[model samples]
Target: MVSKLKSANASAAGQITSRSPRQIAWRRFRRNKVGMVSAGISIVVLMLSLFAPVVCKILGINPDELNLDLIDSSGIPTLPNGGISWEHPLGLTPGIGRDLLANLLYGSRISFLVAFLTTGLAIFIGLIVGIVGGYFRGRIDDYLGRFTDFLLAFPAFFMIVALSEPMVARIQETGIAQGNGARVIFLIFFLSFFGWPGFSRLVRSQVLSLRERDFVTAAQAMGASRKRIIFKELMPNLWAPVIVVVSLSLPGYLAAEAVFSFLGIGIQPPATTWGILLDNARRFVTVYPNFFLITAGSLVLVVLAFNLVGDALRDALDPRSER
Candidate 1:
């Protein structure tokens, strides 16, 4: 009993202190070994991607520059084993003598940038439609709900594929954007245009319940402006889920970019993307299996890392979950 009392006293005096939610979340996240490892990998990849240009400058390599010497008469890379030489770190791309490491790094940067932009646009549209619909909960909600449902049921992927060529042409005709630039604008539009319904539904469901909370009710009783109550009272509480949703949504958009690029509909030529690499990989898969492996492996690694981090965030932010 005396020992127990002393231990409790020690904890109360030194070991125990009130932690903010952010601190508690970080503590819980650190306890998650898999999450920590994945986060480190993600941070490393993002950093490398962000500084790809500087790194390439230091290495004196242009990712898009074609080195005809590296290509043999047979159109296969001259290097015997995946191009790992003093000049080329990861290797020379099979038919194209562009540096593999350089392309990979640049690909990472562009792919993530597109994913981030698409996710942001989707989240913004979702937030607006969701909060308004949930708070009003009447004819207004019904109209908004139906619109989102229509988007959910629509064949967005097929539409994108079917319209890709003409869409790019149309955008180019309008002089808004051209070449792959136009394609990029079209791709971002198609993605975010159709991608928002799911998140909107998630937010609406959350807002529906959160609106009746004690704090919200107190705000209402205190004659807070509708706009203020919605933005201040409810929106602040929505951040946790919004963050988790955003984290989870990125990989999907990343894959989407890769898929469209592979199919010749995504960001156009001269762009170094994993999808473009994979699309090219099919031609040499039988002879140069390593080529396929590196591209596919990189994609798998980044996606898995993102998914694990998203799961960790979901767990860490759940108020009911045990530490």
Candidate 2:
């Protein structure tokens, strides 16, 4: 009986020890009901956006193709006169007569793409700068710190606004950044350019505190290469904070893209982003409020879902939290 008990205890202990940190973290995240729900909604939104082309094909609707026959003499969709049909369930735009549902799905793809790419680029730059600067801790640190301070003081929004027209003109002349694709690339560049400073500073501060820890010191004393020590030892410990920062910042990036588009400097017309849709619908607010409401509602839903998920992630990843 004693031998059997020992064998069972060892098996359980082995299983417990084999579980990875990510598995444990996932378990903790799943226990948070709000977080799980938000994550599910976010995933659904992303999947819909990604598969929008397939959805549009199945629905037999073209987002960019205009149906002038559906418009009245005043160039507005006849949706207000009970013209909504199964073919265009979301009705049609007043001036363009483009399918609202198709536009929404495709627009969501652009929004998600811009947000994800900008966030990824910003994180990459910030991680490199922060890790290198914090690890070196000398003149290199001083230079990077000063650069970061300068970026923090810079007025990114106004700069983008002032330069957008001229930059677009230049890009057009280059024959490289054409049409909506150019605009999308430009917005991604502008947003990511301004997005990294806060993350870099946060990472630098964390690295400063962590570099002096016993494990890092032991790694150094044991003659580990700088690259190995930084990546293998320090990087693993940084994941918790990095993950929190990424979750929190993704919503901000998405909102920034919308704001830029609203101001007319983002993805231009014929490319229907949520911001563009909102701007186009604003003029017909009283005439057809559904257009404005639908776009705005989607924007709010995505942002709210991201914020909720971020909050839940922060709480779950916090070591001090008892959950």
Candidate 3:
């Protein structure tokens, strides 16, 4: 009997050392072809954005410093010397004469910042509203539900248009030193204001279902506080859905930024974003088609990567999977 008990203890110890939820999720993600490809794209893009300064240094180009000499001369959008130097393959812009590649890499930093901030802010606001509304299904829920409906009633683009002018004006008046930093913050705010409702609705639906689950009931029976149950137990269980939503939200946020810029409301002069780059290419698409192709291609890749990864995460993280 003692030997059997010892054997059982050893077995339990071995099981305890097995892969965790995160490890399992990672393994599953790696096994997925689309997920792996998406992850690769995400890593490359993030690295390019993060190390823009280093890349600029290695290329002997100041990302912010403009060279007017190359402006409008445009043979192939290459180097300052006008030869097909491998340094600036995309060529220099007309006004700034900055290396397109360098500007692209640098611009990604701001674009990524806006996308991430917008998604995070939306998620946070959604979580708060969702938890409160879902855990308590009464007057509070009704009020919040109605408020969410009101937010949803407006077309996202129209809402952004209406808000951008006043918000941008306020940021300009703040005197906190204008330029890239200010623009990024304001864009994030704009995206968040229009973006949060979708996430809130998602979370609310998930929480409404989760609140009735057995574990939740057990926690309630064990005298767990509503706060603890909602934040700790309930929220943690919603990780699968949250991961999927966040992954999807990122690309949507990026697209929104691009649209705003395309409409002349986003990243402005002296500060370049992928959207602004695309906007610039729009006028010259017939003349300089490469410009449009490169810019549009990059944006498409980013959006597609996010969507593929989000779908993969949803499948891999599902608790009911036949693991």
Candidate 4:
């Protein structure tokens, strides 16, 4: 009876183990109502943005064109509720006179693009710095830790804002990128510069824990090169945290872009973003509150959706939680 019980337990364990982490995470994520809803919202927003050009075509509106006629002499939309009408469902942007719906769709694409690029670059730098510092202890690690501390301690946000124009100008002078592209390039660089340290520290801690495992010791014993051991034996284990952080931090990066744009330092003129819209609508809040509400509400909705998705991911990937 005891032997039979042991065999059954082992079989059960094997069956449970056979399900991959990804499968388990996905199952858990699917069961979360808030997560599922958030994911749906995120997908819809992304899809809308991805097909923005087509949507604009169907709407018979061009986001880039300025409709001066729609704006009255006072820089407010001619129609009531900030120009909300059948032709312009979300309304015309007050003063600017662009299709609000079209700008929103196009803006999401730009915001997401900047977030992704910044996240990718930051994570790449963090991974390399983390792996080196964690794998090789002592002086190298100490120096890196100090530098990371220094970066974290600095007033990097203001620095980024101050640096924006100069960097954009420098980039333009190089003739590498012009107009919105130059500002975008500079924004990505500065954002990544500020974003990497926290992630690197997280990775370093995880690496420290992992390097002490039996596999790493065995690899060291087998005359494995440092590069091979780090790459082969360690990197595979870092994906869970990476994914979690990326999901969580992406929203922050997106919000950062908006902040800079609101301050008139991000993406520059001729580029309509959530931030730009918010900035434009701010002055008209007393008379035309609807414009501000719509602009701000859209940003809040997307940010909130992304945040919930991130939460769901973190919960699903938590090792201590069987669910």
Best by TM-score: 1
Best by lDDT: 4
Provide the overall lDDT of each model, using Cα atoms, as 2-decimal numbers. Answer: 0.88, 0.86, 0.80, 0.89
Candidate 2, 1-323: lDDT as tens digits: 99999999999988875657677677788999999999998899888899999999999888988888888876678756424678887878878688888999999888889999999999989998999898998999999999989988989999889888778777878988787777777878878888898899988998999999999999999999998999899999899878888887888888888888998998887677888888888887887788788778889998888888898888787767766
For each candidate in turn, the TM-score is: 0.94, 0.91, 0.86, 0.91
Segments of candidate 2 deviating more than 4 angstroms:
1-19, 80-84
RMSD of each: 2.6, 2.3, 3.7, 3.2
Candidate 2 colliding pairs, count: 0
Considering lDDT, where higher is better, how would the candidates rank from best to worst?
A: 4, 1, 2, 3
Better of 1 and 3 by lDDT: 1
Q: Once model 1 is optimally superposed onto the true structure by TM-score, how far is the C-alpha of residue 211 displaced, in angstroms?
A: 0.6
lDDT accuracy of residue 260 in candidate 3: 78
lDDT string, candidate 1, 107-168, tens digits: 87778988999999999999989999999999999999999989999899999999889989
lDDT per residue as tens, model 4, 187-294: 899899988999999999999999999999999999999989888999999998898888888889999999999999997667778888888889999988888999
